[model samples]
Target: MQFFPIFLRSEGARIVVSGGGETALAKLRLLLKTRARIAVHAAEADPKILDWQAEGRLSWVARPVEAADLDGARLVYAATDDAAEDARVAGLARAAGVLFNIVDNREDSAFITPAMVDRDPVVVAIGTEGAAPVLARKIKAGLEAWLPAGLGARVRAANAFRPEAEALPQGRARRGFWAAVFDGALDGRAPEPLDRLLEAHKAARPAVGEVLFVGAGPGDPDDLTMRARRALDRADVVIHDRLVPAPILELARREAEIVEAGKTGFGPSTPQEEINRLIVGRAAEGLVVVRLKAGDPSVFGRLDEEIEACEAAGIAWSVVPGLTAASAAAASLGQSLTRRGRNSDLRVLTGHDVNGLADHDWATLARPGAVAAIYMGKRAARFLQGRLMMHGAEAATPVSVVENAGRPEERILAATLGTLATEIASTELTGPAVILLGLAPRAAARSLPLLQEAAR
Candidate 1:
């Protein structure tokens, strides 16, 4: 509340800047960004300023700022390091009824320049009210990285469709149409043809609802992809899974309907058919629906079944891949799933099949130095241990069980294969976990004594 921020209209307006060094040059750089008619009052100016004046970008007064220099100016900058001269310039500007800013002097100025991200017509300004310029620049740097370089071009392209979008009634219909276009186009999804979009809007046809299969990466909300976050923001209905954490779910629009279609091992689960029905049914209501799944939906997430259902229903669908549990678990254990000269191939296996605990090529899996990540393996830990051991796998093979990967409650149990089942049984894990075989926690060497005792 120290200072209120506002964007001044600079087009064709006169702006006077005082001083000649870097401070004046700095203000001139920002002023040049606008279409303002700049005039500099400097006894001796920088070569760049002289060049700019020669190029007709700004007029040079070639003298110190005086009362007459403040006349007819819309805005003025007293950028001289001299405090007395700056105060005089500020007084003259105030009397002339113009906006004034003193460079590096918040108390003496009417306004302060903010860290700005300019995407042509789209401008984002971050100011700390002259309290934290460094922090403001840091934020600007982050925004520069997050925003696409071609955003200005994309925004310009969208302008052409605003008229067409206006064909729809103002309010939800028009906003939804534009939202879809921006969200889709920004993410590289092709927009509908302009004519078709206009016609659809004109006719007031119910916008075809879309189903976004967003991967809520592992369990952390921060792990959610930008695209996934946009999907949640626009979603009218979010059909989420059990493994999808509450924090991620809370990201959805406040008015969005949240439905839990979570499936857990040996627990009451929402039937797959019911989940498909819910997605299709919600989308059919002309609502943007999100099928939020934990980890990569492609990895044992029954994604294909839902996608197939969506296709059958003639609903448009898209997928936003997320960080799967295996990757997060590996990160938690501080080990790579495939290490140089250690293991070249990595197998991601499921604990259960349609019938029961799934069986894999044990011989290959049991090979020394073989590495695999087992998903949904908590209930089948003993079965998996027995099979691997029976296939000539050594009992001393390293195994890491990562529960609640990427979550604050995450636990890493490092043990040899001989005691993986026993260690897993000893702990109560209510969160989805991944089991790493033939790969040990980074601390496995240090925990060897405890691991050996647990096996006994």
Candidate 2:
């Protein structure tokens, strides 16, 4: 902030150089494009500078700067070996209402050029404001990767569309149209002039309040439906929960602001009401907002309040469903919740005694040939099994304990209900386990290979 940032064009302007070596020659060659009236004061000249003098590209005098160097000079550069003469010329320029730069001496000069990134006519000028040119160059290099080579052409293309945007009557419709265009959301060349299309776009602007409920899905990112991916990509801002992994978050647009609502079982979570505010606020700003939650939003996810808020705001929104962990767990273990006549009923429950198991109808668990998917039932499996047995349930029932379902690291334990405790005790696996209980048909059952000897 301490350094002034300004662009200078020396065309038909007066400027002075006080050096004749490679440094001065290089500076002079760059200035020739500006068509600046440049005069050099040096005792000796480099070969390039001498050739330019012979060709009349620039003019120079001998014995460095004397009294005559300040004549009509608007700017002066003290790029000389003699520090004493550089200071004298700098002082003269200062008294003559001129800007002087004693090269490399920022304290003694008015201007200090920076190592710039010139993708002109789309130049990105990075300056430390003369604080640190080296640091400025480093910053420029980092930006070189993301910036396209044809950025100058892209800038020209955008400028060409200014006429189309201005021709439309001034209003929110017109402003919003351009806002969506130059918002940097779209890259590369502008499309063909589609005036007819613009009218349709302006007329069909999206609702002010609309929520896009996105499903984070079970652990794996690939399991996310195509609809879910599109929903995330269109989101102006994302209000994501904890279970949504970092990889899934990367799929969102770079400008799509991300806000973490620590809704995970254990984490630094954002409060629910605040999350609701963020989603609604972004949507209200005519933004496509996505609320990302693990599993389907309507399930355990606090979709109730979010839905109510969206409804109250009068926003148009939709839901994108995902593969719930329960289904994933069953699929990973090659088990089914229902098997034709084998399982007449299929039940899903949380064994964590959400409030109390006494309130739960444990007697329904005694039904014959019924399948049950128990979520987070690893620790309470034995207690639930005891309840089932007491409720007239058969002691021998096929059960598969699936953990880390449908992931690269999936494991399953197949055992009878009576040995549930003993079987789970042998496996040290933990974290979000599910239990699939029922009698499996032969095709669904997993069996070890048996050696069959053919007598030869």
| Candidate No. with top lDDT | 1
TM-score of 2: 0.53
Model 2, residue 446: displacement in angstroms? 9.0
Full-model lDDT, candidate 2: 0.72
- Give me the overall lDDT of model 1: 0.86
lDDT of 1 by residue, 177-271 (tens): 66655665545465566666566656676577899999999989988889999889989899999888788999998878999998878878999
Candidate 2: where is the Cα deviation over 4 Å? Answer: 1-192, 199-207, 264-271, 353-359, 421-430, 439-456
The models' CA-based lDDT, in order, is 0.86, 0.72
> Which candidate should be chosen as best, given TM-score against the real structure?
1
Instruction: Provide the lowest-lDDT 10-residue window in model 1.
Output: 445-454
- Residue-level lDDT of model 2, residues 1-456, one tens digit each, is 666778887677878899888677766765775668878888988877777778887887876776667878878888886789889888888888788888878887788766656565666678776777778878989777656676666557666767776756554456456555544523554544446546765577454646889888876778889998877777778888776778889999787789887653333667778887888878888777889987678766778888888888887778888887778866665566666767667777777643644234678877777778786677777888888888887878777776666555555666777888777776676555677777332344434210111111
| TM per candidate | 0.61, 0.53
